[model samples]
Target: MTADDYVEQASEIFVLSDSFIRIRELIDDEASTIDDISEVILLDPALAGTVLKLANSPFFNYPGKIDTISKAVLVLGITEVYNLVIAYFTTEAFKKINANQAYLDDFWIKSIDCALLMKFLGTSLGIVHAERLFILGLLHNLGELVVHQLTLEKHTACESNDINLLPWHKQQDILGFTFGECSAGLLKEWQLPYNIFAAIRDQDIDDLSQYNVETQLLYIAKRVMSKNQVFKGQSLDYSSLVTKEQLELLCLDKNMLENAVDYCDLERLSLLAILNPRASMLY
Candidate 1:
């Protein structure tokens, strides 16, 4: 199917939950208070639980526990709470697709890894609106979900795995374009933000000059997460995933990159344990 076809399909068939829709509206309203947003979040028990977990997680580093959605709001602030809601909300949206639990877990773990790093690098590198990058990193592979839902069974049944085609190209072979392209299209339809959809589309661009720092953050997060996911459940140096050139682009040195790599692992499992408490396979 064409990229347009996938975008149309996702817009029509892949519905965003009501809670997410309200939360999105809440973020846009200059007058929306923490209570207004928290009331909406509390309506969904699942979203509340996840939001509380995130607020309590090292991601926030709140001094005391965040037991209620309202407290989570107070601790995380309006902007941060909104960002966290979008991250979890978008995750639930794609989980409705037909990927099996095993596949979903893998996807979840990888995306979380990328997201954690984006938050880390964006902050350390002094990028404004780092919270937005967290959302970008989490949803970076969304088009992969669309393509996987459409072609996964057949793609797996194919006995030959092309050694030469890059993963994104292999995706293009299966779908009309890469997941990044598909993600941009869907985000555009959702009317989220221009820079977000624009940066999502720029992830695969080879030339750094073509991307602003925000898009570059998205690109590097993907690269590091791809490598880190492969190295999961094994003992290996993921520091190699952070190269000198990638560091230079971020105006960071090797030490910061390595620290971020280490932090990715340290936090990935902790976040996974809380997010996917039932999935023992992550062990």
Candidate 2:
């Protein structure tokens, strides 16, 4: 297999919902009115239920209950509502297969932790379109989900005792790509915005010349999220992967990084409980 092979396979992975595709198209076209967006959202009953649940969740902290999609949109702002909708739609993209439940849970927990931290850091830095930044953070690792799914059949062949040593990326390499590369390709095929594609692709390391401040913030946030002591085993050092010049370009500092981690730690636990109450209870 080659990079092209992996890209082709990734492109073939069916998105489960046509409504999701339409919603992405509408938002990308800059749907301006609540009515216009609401009409699209109401097409999916599951999505409508999620929007209402999210609006009333502690994340939003609405004083009163929100019953209608239109009211939820009004209270949450279109950008926020859009972000929440996407988050809900995409949250289930990763599901545990025969992989160790503990490992899968931990991976998702870290992903959510990193995403929330990125969102907080982006907002605190006064980045324009912070909500989009949050969405990027949330969806940045979706490529990993794709890779895991694509290779599931192969992965199951490993002896149970040998599973830990399976070298996941080698499978990707054999299949001719990395999940990051495959994911970026998928995002491009999906026609998502340039910022999102750039954020995920460049997240491996900082390249000041290619990406702007917004993209750089994502790089920093991913690193910070990875380094959380909870994910110490999987964390990579951004300083080594990124150049000093790139760090200087982004105006990154230890203080902001620390603040982001502290905020994400609290919020991620809450989000986990909200998103997967049963798993939260068990773990």
Candidate 3:
């Protein structure tokens, strides 16, 4: 099927929460207050529970407990609370699918880790609207889900557990397009930001000089998370993985990359647990 066909099928494949749309709009409004966000969230008990659980989780690193949704928004900031809720919602987007449980778990863990790292990296670089990167990173690989679902229908022989080749490469071979291209189509369908669309479309650029720093940062964040998941034993040698010009372009030195690795190491587990609580309990 063509890219348009894939996107068209995606709308029917996943059901987005209406409250998510309202919360997204509410957070974007300049005059929005914590109460407004709380009210929107309180409309859905599931969303409210997710927010409160995460707010009290060690991931937030807050001392006292955060009981109310309003206080969660106030302490976590509107953007953060919004990102967490949306990110969690995205995690639940594809339940009751016939994919390998292990593969599905890795896909989400890596997505959340990369998105969190993107936010952290964005803040260090003083990039505005960094919270958007959370969704950007979370949804960056959504096209893969579309393709996986299509594959499940016997459209192709792509197995969810298959890892002989990278996912994007396999997608390119099977669907004649990379997940990046597919994600671009889906993001456009959702009417997300132009910068996010551009960044994901170019997140894998090998020629770092051609793209902006934001894309490069995403590439780095994705690579770091992938390495952490796929390479737990060995050390990450950025001297070889990251080019000198790329590092210089992004104003990132060895120290920053190392620090990010350390941060990932410390936070990756807690984050996986908090973000995938159900799966966390199983494993």
CA lDDT for candidate 3? 0.72
- For TM-score, candidate 2 versus 3, the one ahead is 3
Question: Which model scores highest in lDDT?
Answer: 1
Comparison by lDDT, 2 against 3, better one: 3
Off by over 4 Å in 3: 28-33, 62-65, 123-132, 152-170, 210-212, 231-236, 239-241, 281-283
lDDT of 3 at 91: 68
lDDT string, candidate 2, 137-232, tens digits:
767666666656667654344212222342223444355444555566667776666766777776654355676766677666665664553336
Q: Which pairs clash in model 3?
A: none
Tens-digit lDDT track of model 3 for 1-283: 8877888888677656788888878877889888988998999988888878877865566899899998988777887787677667766667755688886887777777777777677767888756556667777777777777776653344333223454455566777777777777877776555776788887767787888767888878876666566544566566535578777888888787667767655666666776676555444
Clashes of 3: 0
Q: TM-scores for all candidates?
A: 0.85, 0.77, 0.80
CA lDDT, candidate 3, residue 214: 73
Better of 1 and 3 by lDDT: 1
> Which ranges of candidate 2 are over 4 A from the true structure?
28-33, 56-67, 96-100, 152-177, 229-245
Model 2 has an lDDT value of 0.64
- For candidate 1, give the lDDT of residue 105: 88
Instruction: For each candidate in turn, give its C-alpha RMSD to the true structure in angstroms.
Output: 3.3, 4.7, 3.7
